[model samples]
Target: MATGWAGDNAVQDQIDATVEDAVKRARSQLNQGPSLTHCEECAAPIPTARRQAVPGVRLCVGCQEVRDQQAAFSGYNRRGSKDSQLR
Candidate 1:
């Protein structure tokens, strides 16, 4: 039930595409090798608890928090302009 000019499966297709993109992003972030003992950004000692809790943990709590904050501010434009959509 697409509400726009697109076909019935348009909305479902968009949803599926979004989910696939999220999965790909998550998989890319997954650590493929050993976890670092120190924070890569600040060179601070990464706690054993954190390392154990999150396998492949790269940054410490503080650095990770800052990184998360930066990520939060990076907005995404899901809706493209009419001209772009027409293409």
Candidate 2:
């Protein structure tokens, strides 16, 4: 049921949007050209295991973690619908 403001489904919609964004990002990253032998952040060697596990990976494990965290914090602009604009 709706509460004081947005309905209960509003939170569900936000979750769905977040998942969609994550999937889209993962797909684009997978389609990247190639993996780099060395990490761009610390110049550490990118292990073969990581390269094989994550296709088109560019950063080392440590660097990748940091980058991923940064990306997660950078919220998406999920406002393409006309209904959203009406608000």
List per-prediction Cα lDDT, in the order shown. Answer: 0.87, 0.82
Which residue window of length 10 is worst by lDDT in model 2? 26-35
Where model 2 places Cα greater than 4 Å from the true spot, the runs are 1-26, 29-31, 74-87
lDDT measured at residue 48 in model 2 versus the true structure, 0 to 100: 92
Please list all clashing residue pairs in model 2, or write none if there are none. Answer: none
Residue-level lDDT tens digits of model 1 in 13-44: 99999999999999998876667999999999
Q: How close to the true structure is residue 75 of candidate 1, measured as C-alpha lDDT?
A: 53
Reference-based lDDT, residue 81, model 2: 91
Give one digit per residue, the lDDT tens place, for model 2 in 26-74: 7775637688889888999999998887777778989878878887884
Candidate 1 lDDT at 42 equals: 91
Ten contiguous residues minimizing lDDT sum, candidate 1: 74-83
Candidate 2's TM-score? 0.52
Cα TM-score per model: 0.65, 0.52
